[model samples]
Structures are given as C-alpha cells and as structure tokens.
Target: MKLISTSNYEKLSQQAGEEIISRIKRNPTLNLGLATGSTPTGLYQELIKDHKQHKTSYKEINTFNLDEYIGISKKDRNSYHYFMCEHLFEHIDIPLDQTHIPDGTAKDLDEECSRYEQFINEHGGIDLQILGIGQNGHIGFNEPGTPFDSRTHIIDLAESTRKANSRFFESLDDVPKQAITMGIASIMDSKEIFLLVSGASKAKALATLMNGDVREDFPASALKNHGNVTIFADKDATALL
Candidate 1:
C-alpha cells in the first residue's frame, strides 16, 4: 500500500486524476473501475478538464462503475448511472456501449449480480479500480461486517450510509435502502486500486485504514492485502494519521 497526501481536496483530486491519465496514456484500452459520491466528484471534474485541455481520449476505454442504488432507473437523477453520465461518461469520448454499470432495476437481482461478475471476468478484469472510503470505512457499499470473500452482490445500505447520502436526495426517506455493489473480492481482483479520501469527516476512517489491521469489520482494511493499492488523501482526511 502507498499513501500520498496533499494540502487540500483540489490537489488530491489533481494528483489522482493525473495518475489515471498516466495509466490511460500507457494503455488506452484500460478497464477502469469507477466510484460515485462527493469524494470522487472532484476527481471526475479534473478528468473532464484533462479531456478538454489535453484531449486525453477515452474512446477505447472500458469503464465499470462500482455500484448503483437498487430500485432506481438509469434516468433517475439520484441513480449512479445518471451520476456517472453526468459526471464523466457524457463528457468523455468513450463509447456509451463500452461503459458498464449494474442494472439496479433488474427484475432478478441475483442473476444480475452473477452476470455482472461474469461480465467483469469476460473483460479480463479491471486494470485499475477507483474507490472512496466511507466515514464508517465502507468501500463500494460493502459495509462493515461484509465478508471479505464475497462477490458481486446486493447489500442493505447501512443506516449511517443512507443518512450520509441523504444530502443528495429530496429527503432522507427518499434515499434508497439497498444497493448492488462490487464485493470486496471483486474489487480485490483489480490489478491496481486507487483510494481517494478527503474531508475531515473521513479522518477517523483513514486513520483506521492506515493502521494496517486487516479485519472484515472494517471493509476498507481489506485493501491492505492487495499488492498494489495507492491512497490519495487530502490533509483533512489524513489529519488523524
């Protein structure tokens, strides 16, 4: 595991974006695992800027999002599908058909999870996976207590997770109670992982991750077992370190 800290969130985003751009330049056909939420918004913005200024093309790139809220349609503003389109996909040159996100409204969610796992394998696994640690140390909605060996599956969003996401919804009650997320095992399959942590709210979680305790109780800690994991955190997020 490698840690890189910056003075503020903007610099952290720039550093993370530059790393992603470098990887893309090395392999234009890179399979990227993406994350949603406020933490990654800045990073996505930086990527968009690079796309506009440097013409860093994603035309040959393949992207797979980390998770999506259950019961939400792709058109729903709150859906991860819409989030990705608004934040990254629509702005990039990548073909829409090559960008994959779990169908949160699939009639048979179990089959969907299985298919998503298979789809990822068919693509030769993700080359790089982007992640954001939750205040409670959850990664890609794989909340605390989630088995480290689990695969792509549905999860009941933790109360704290839902409450934190409430800001994006009209009201707390409007937040989805469940989601389909790439399991810890699925995430670990990535050749490399980039974890972006920002804000003082995540300081405790960042501290816990850096402590090197590989316990399932703290899902993010599972990354310690991965050979190539880089953390780009802002000073506020690493203050407790």
Candidate 2:
C-alpha cells in the first residue's frame, strides 16, 4: 500500500482521474470499478472536464459501479444509476451499454447479483478500481465486520452509514436500510485500486485504518494486504497517520 498526501481536494480528484486516464489511454476498453458518494464527486467532475478539454473520450470504456441502494428505482434521484449519468456519463462519451450499475429494483436480487459477477468475470476483471471509504471503514457498502471472503450480495446498511447517507434523503426513514454491493473478494481482484478519502469526519476512520492491524472489524484494513492499492488523503484526513 502506498500513502499519498494530496495538496487539496482538487489535487486528490485529479490524481484519481489520472488513474483512469492512464488506463483508458493504454486500453480504450479498460474495465473500471467505480464508487459513488460525495468523496468521488470531484473525481467524476474532473474526468468530465478532461474529456471535454483533452478529448479523453470514454467511447469504449467498461464501467462497473460499486454499489446501489436496494429497492430504489433507477429513476429515483438517489439511485446510483441516476448519480452516474447526472455526474459523469451524460457529459462523457461512454457508450450506454459499456456502463453497468446494479439495478436497484430487481425482482430477483440474487439473480441480479449473479449476473453482475458474471458480467465482470467475462470482461476479464476490473483493470482499475476507485473506492471511497465509509466513516466506519466500509467499502462499496460492505460495512465493518463484513467477511473478507464474502461475495456480491444484499446487505443491511449500518446505522452510521445510514445516518451519513441520510443527507441525500428528506428523512432518515426515507433512507433505504438495504443496499447491494460488490464484495471485497471481487474488489481485491482488480489489478489496481485507488482508495480516495476526504473530509474531517473521515479522520477517525482513516487514522484507525492507517494505525490498525489487518482485521475483519475494519474492512478497509484489508487494503493494506493488497499489493497494488494506493491511498490518497487530504491533510485533515491523514492527520492521525
């Protein structure tokens, strides 16, 4: 694992964007693992700007989002699918079919999970993965204490996660307590991983992860064992490190 202290949020976003740019430049069809939430919003904006200014088109890039709120319709404002297009896809050149976000309203959730994994497997796994850590060390909604051996599945949102995510909803009850997320096993399969962390609230989690041993209690700790994971942090987020 490599630790990168970014100058600021903009720099962090660019670093993350450059990761995808490098991969896209190397192979237009690079399979990308993506994350949602405020942390990655800046990175998405940067990619869109790069596409406009530098013509870094995503015409053939294959993207697989990390997670989505269960039971939320794709048209819902808070859905990951909605977030992707509103933030990045609509402004870029990525083919609609090349982007994959788990359908939140699937009638058979199990079948949806299976197909998602299969789709990724047939694509030769993710070439580059971008992640944003939950305040409790969760990644892709695989909350704290999630088994490292687990696979893609439906999971109840942790209280803290729900509370943190509630900002997007009008009320706490409006926040879906369940979500479908890509498992750590699949995330670990990526050839390269970039873990982007920011905000003062994330300080404790970041510090704990940087200081703690590799344990199941804090799922993000598992990244320490991955050979190609890079962690980028703003000064406040890395203060405890």
Candidate 3:
C-alpha cells in the first residue's frame, strides 16, 4: 500500500488522471474498473480534458463499473449506469459495448451477479480499479461488516450510506435500499487499485484505513491485504492520519 497526499482535490485528481492516462497509453487494451460519486468526478473531468487535448484514446479500453442501485432502471438519473454515462462514458471514445455495468434491474439479481463475475473473469480481471472510500469505510457499496472473502453479490445499503446519498436524490426515501456490488474478493483480483479519498468527512475513515487493524468492520481495510494498492488522498481526507 502507498499513500500520496495532495494539497487539494484538484491536485489529487490531476495526479491520478496523469497516471491513468499514462497507463492507458502504455496498454490501450487495459481493463479499467470504475467508481462513481463526487470523489471521482474531478478525475473523470481530467480524463475528458486529456482526451480532447491530447487525443488519449479509449477506443480499445474495456470498463467495468463497481456497483449499481438494485431497484433503479439504468435510465434513471440516480442509477450508477446513468451516472457513469453522464460523467465518463459519454465523453470518452470507448465503445459502449465494451463498457460493462451490472444490470440492476435484472429479473434474477443473483444470476446477474454471477454472470457479471464470470464476465470479468473472462476478460482476465481488471488491470486497474478506481475506488472511493465512503465516510464509513465502505468500498463499492460493500458496507461495514461485509466479509472480506465475499464475491460479487447484492448488499443491503447501510443506513448511513443511504443518508449520505440522499443529497443526490430528492429525499432519503428516494434512495435505493439495496445494490449489487463487486465483492471485496472481486476487487482484490484487480492487478492494481487506485483509491481516492477527499473531503474532511472522510478523514476519520482514511485514518482508520491507514492505522487500524484489518477487519471486516471496515470494508476498505481489505485493500491492505492486496499487494498493489495506491491511495491518492487530499489533505482534508488525511487530516486524521
């Protein structure tokens, strides 16, 4: 595990973007794992800017998103599918067919989870995965107490998570109660992991991740067991560290 602290969110995003862009250039066929939420929006913007300014091609890139709300339609504005499209997919040169996100509305969600896991295995797993630590240390909706060895599966969103996400919806009740997320084991399969932590709200979580023991109670701590994980955090997020 490596920690790179920056003065602010923009600087962290820029550094992360440059690294990702360099990786894409070196391996155009990179299997990229993506994350949603406010933390990564700046990084996505940086990618978009570079794609336009330097013509960094994503044409051969294959992207797999982290999670999606279980009860939302893909077209729903609140859905992770729509979030990815709006924030990154629509702006990139990557083929839509090559970008994979779990079907949240699948009739049999368990089957969908299994299929998605199989699909990732077929692609040789993710070369690099982007992650954002939740205020409660969740990763990809794998909330606190999620088993570290778990595979792709459905999870009941923690109440705190729902409350935090309420800002994106009209009300707390509008947030989905459950989601399908790539499990900790699935995430650990990635060749490398890029974790982004910003804002004072996440300072305690980041501190715990940096100094606490490995345990299921803090999902993000699972990364500590991985050989290749880099954390790009801003000063605010690292204050407690």
Candidate 4:
C-alpha cells in the first residue's frame, strides 16, 4: 500500500524501470510477471531505452504475462500478446522462447487456465509482478467478485473494464467479453509487486485502491496483504489519492 508519486509520467516510468533493472541484475534469471495497459506503456518505453543504452540486459529473465483476452488471435492488434511484443518484448534482448503468455485461442480454456498456473509454479513462481489497475480497481482482469484466493481462470469483463479498455477497440462491441487472468492468490505469491499507474483517467481507481477498504468490490484492495508492494504513479494518477 506504499505510494510514490512523481512530477510526471516519464520520470515515474524511468524510476520504476530502474528498480526492475536492479532486480534483474541481482538475479539474471529472475522470474518476472508482466501486465499490459496504457499505464505501463511509458515504463516499457524506458526499458527499451535502457536496453539500447546497454544499462540493462534481459538475456536470462523469464516473463509470465498476467492476462489475455480470450477468443482473440495473437495477431490481433488488441491482443495482449501483440501489445507486449510491440511495446517491450521486441525491443529487449529476452528470447521469445523464455517468455510465457497465456494462449488466447485455446480450445479448452479450463485446461489452459490450469496449465498456465501449473507452469508458473514449476518455473519457481514470479519474483516480481507488474500491475495496472482498471478503472473499477480490477487487476489482471480479475474484476470485482473474483475470490481473493483464486488462481488462474476465465472471467467476464466488468462493464467498467470494457469501457476503459474500449479505447483500443473499434467499438465496445469489438472488445472481447471474456479474458484469462492470474488470480489474487497468484499475484500475492510474487516476491515483489510493482503497481504502475499514470493519467487522470486512472486517478479514481488509484485512489480507491490505495485508501479504500480491503474488499472484493475493489479487487486491487486485496493487494494490501502482500508484504512487498510498491505503487508508482504520475501526478495525474495520484491526484485523487
């Protein structure tokens, strides 16, 4: 529940990226968890810059993305897989084979969900997890009512989430109805967590998650129980808080 605000998004992004780089340097083979959203776009850009400057190397790191829209192809512009490659994976030195993103087109989603969580456990769980809060306080697509102890699973997107995410879609109708995401338990298992938020649009959710009660109605509130968590936000995002 710790909060750190910066004068602007760029500096916040850089600081957060530096912290991640330090962790990776401490352990070249760190198991990292990733989140995708407009909030983290700047952070990814800074990481790209770090790689170009030779300040960071992702050669042996392993990444597990938090969620993916179900029923979408990896080639889809709005897919998390596509977004990750466009923003960070493509610019970094991490091998594609070392990254793990949930399959959006799996025929048996239940099996896919089970396997995804199992794979995480086998890989030593996530050492660091990056998260972005939805407008309604959802994290990793685990919208309100998602049990705090749950693991990976399929879920319907809340209306607030759909509206917030629709900016990347042709229309609200084009947004997928469902997604597969790591649950609250899975996220809490991470040794460290970094929650990034930027922009005025996220101010309300950021405020709520930071000061609100620990309840399922605000899914991100569940994060308070984690022993090591850092929340980084730009002024705009921290305005409400």
Candidate 5:
C-alpha cells in the first residue's frame, strides 16, 4: 500500500485526477471502477476540467460504478446513475454505452448480482478501481462485518451510513435503506486501487486503516491484502496518523 497526503481537498483531488488521467493516457481502453459520494465529487470535477482543457478523452474507456441504492430508478436525482451523469459522464467524451452501473431496480436482484460479477470478469477485470472510505471504514457500502469473500450483492445500509447520507435527502426516511454494492472480493480483483479520503470526519477511519489490523470487522482493511493500493488523502483525513 502507498500513501500520498495532500495539504487540502483540492490538492488531493488534483493528485488523484492526475494519476487517473495518466493511466487513461497509457491505456485509453482501461476498465475503470468508479465510486460515488462527496469524497469523489472533487476528483470527478478535476477530470471534467482536464477533459475540457487537455482533451483527455474517455471515449474508449469502460467504466463500472461501485454501487447503487436499491429501488431507485436511474432517473431519480438521488440515484448513482443520476449522480454520475450530472457529475462526470455528461461532461466527458465517454460513450454512454461504455459506462456500466448495477440496475438496483432490477426485478431479479439476485440474477442481477450474478450478471454484474460476470460482466466484470468478461471485461478482463477492472484495471483500476476508485474507492472512498466511509467514516466507519465501510468501502462501497460493504459495511463492517461484511464477509471479505463476498461478491456483488444487496446489502442493508448501516444506520450510521443512512444518517450520514441524510444530508442528500430531505429526511432520514427518504434515504434508501438498501443498496447493491460490489463486495470486498470483487473490489480486490482490481489490478490497482486508488482510495481517496478527505476531511476531519474521516480521520479516525483513516488512522485505523493505516495502523490497525486487517479484519473483516472493518471492510476497508481488506485493501491491505491487495498488491497495488494507493491512498490519496488530505491532511485533515490523515491528521490522526
């Protein structure tokens, strides 16, 4: 695991975005795994700026998002689908068909999970996976206690997660209680992983990830077992380190 600490959020985003752009330049057809939430918003914005200024094209890139809220339609403003379109996809040159996100509203969710796993495999696995660690150390909604060997599947969102996400909704009741997320095993399959963490709110989690033991109780710790994992964290997020 490699760690890169930035002075602030903007530097963190720039550092992460530069690495991604570098990779995309080296491999235009890269299969990129994406994560959502506030942590990655800045990085996405930086990518948008690069697309406009440097013409770094994503036209041949294949993107697979990390998760989506269950029962939400793609058109829902709160959906990851909508979030990606608004934040990055619509602004870039990536073909809409090249981007893939799990269908959280699929009638046969179990089959959808299997299909998602199969799709990743058929694409030769993700060349690089982007991740954002939750305050509780959850990764891609794979909350604490989730088995490290699990696959893409539906999960009951943790209460703390729901509470944290409430800011995006009018009320806690409006936040979806369930989601479909790529499991720890699925994430570990990536050839390389980039974890972006920012803010004082995540300091404790970042400390734990850096100093604590690798255990299923903290899902993000699974990355320790991966051969190539880089962490781009802002000073506030690494203060506890």
Candidate 6:
C-alpha cells in the first residue's frame, strides 16, 4: 500500500486525475471500476475538464460501477446509475453500452448479482478500481463485518451508512435500507486500486485503516492485503494518521 497526501482536495483530485488519464492513454480500452458519492465528485469533474480541454478519449473505455441501492430505478435521482450519468458518464465520450452498473430493480436480485459477477469476470476483471472509504470504514456498500472473501451480493445497509446517506434524500426514512455491492474479494481482484480519502469526517476512519489490524470489523483494512493499492488523501483525511 502507498499513501500520497496532498495539501487539499483540489490538488488530490488533480493528481489522481493525472494518474487515471495516463492509464487511459496507455490503454484506451481499460476496464475501470468506478465509485459514486461526494468523495469522487471532484475527481469526476477533473476528468470532465480533461475530456473537454485535452480530448482524453473514453470512447473505448469500459466502466463498471461499484454499487447501487436495491429499491431504486435507474431514473431515480438518488440511484447510482443517475449519479454516474450526472457526474461522469454523460460528460465523457464513453459509450453507454460499455458502461455497466448493477440493476437495483431486478426482480431476481440474486440472479442479477450472479450476472454482474460473471460480467466482470468475462471482461477480464477490473484493470483499475477507484474507491472511497465510508466514515465507518466501509467500502462500496460493504458495511462493517462484511467477510473479506465475499463476492458481489446483497447487503443490508448499516444504520450508520443509511444515516450518512440521508443527506442525499429528504429524510433518513427516504434512504434505501438495502443495496448490492461488489465484495472485498471482488474489489481485490482489480489489477490496481486507488483509494481516495478527503475531509475531516473521514480522519478517524483513515487512521483506523492505517493503524488497525486486518479484521473484517473495519472493511477498508482489507486493502492492506492487496499488493497494488495506492491511497490518495488530503491533509484533513490523513490528520490522524
């Protein structure tokens, strides 16, 4: 694991953007694993700027998102699908056909999970994965205590997670209580991983990730077992480290 701490969020986003753009230049058909939420919004904006300014082509890039709320439709504003389209996908040249996100409204969610897992395997796994750690140390929607060996599966959102996400909804009750997320093992399969951390809200979690034992109680600790993990963080997030 490698840690690169920047002075602030903008610098962090710019540096991370450079790394991603370089990778895309090297392999236009790169299979990218993406994450949603505010932590990555800046990075997405930077990518958009690059696309407009330098014409960084994403026409052949294949993107797979990390997770989605179980009860929401793709059109729902809060859905990860909508989030991607708003934040990154629609702005880039990547084809909608090549962008993959788990179907949260599938009648047979178990089958959907299987299909998602198989789809990733068929594409030769993720070449690069971008991740953001939750305040409770969760990755994707894999809350605390999720087995590190787990795969793509359904998860009951932890109370802390739901509360954290409530800001996006009108109220806490409006938040989805369940989600489908790629598991730790699924994430570990990526050839390279970039873990982005920002703001003081994540300071303690980042501290735990750096100092705590490799236990399932703190999900991000699982990254310690991966060989090619690089952490891009801002001073606020790394304050306690």
Reference-based lDDT, each prediction: 0.96, 0.89, 0.96, 0.91, 0.96, 0.96
Residue 201 in model 4: lDDT: 86
Cα RMSD to the true fold for all candidates: 0.7, 0.9, 0.5, 1.0, 0.5, 0.5
Residue 29 lDDT in model 1? Answer: 94
Number of clashing pairs per prediction, in order: 0, 0, 0, 0, 0, 0
The alpha-carbon deviation from the true structure for residue 110 of candidate 4, after best TM-score superposition, in angstroms, is: 0.3
Query: What does candidate 3's lDDT look like per residue over 1-241, in tens digits?
Result: 9999999999999999999999999999999999999999999999999999999999999999999999899899999999999999999898999999999999999999999999999999999999998999999999999999999999999999999999999999999999999999999999999999999999999999999999999999999999999999999998998
- What lDDT tens digits, residue by residue, belong to model 5 across residues 146-230? 9999999999999999999999898999999999999999999999999999999999999999999999999999999999999
Q: Write the per-residue lDDT of candidate 1 for residues 1-241, one digit (tens) a residue.
A: 9999999999999999999999999999999999999999999999999999999999999999999999999999999999999999999899999999999999999999999999999999999999999989999999999999999999999999999999999999999999999999999999999999999999999999998699999999999999999999999998999
**CA deviation > 4 Å runs, candidate 4:** none
Q: Model 4 compared with the native: what TM-score?
A: 0.97
- Please give the TM-score that candidate 2 achieves against the real structure: 0.98
TM-scores, all models, native as reference: 0.99, 0.98, 0.99, 0.97, 0.99, 0.99
Residue 136's lDDT in candidate 1: 92
lDDT of 4 by residue, 1-241 (tens): 6788999999889989999888888899999999999878888898899889975888889999999999999999999999999999999999999889999799999999999999999999999999988878899999988999999999999887888889999999999999999989989999999999888988998878877889988889988999899999999998887
lDDT of 5 at 103: 96
Residue pairs clashing, model 4: none
Give me candidate 3's TM-score against the actual structure: 0.99
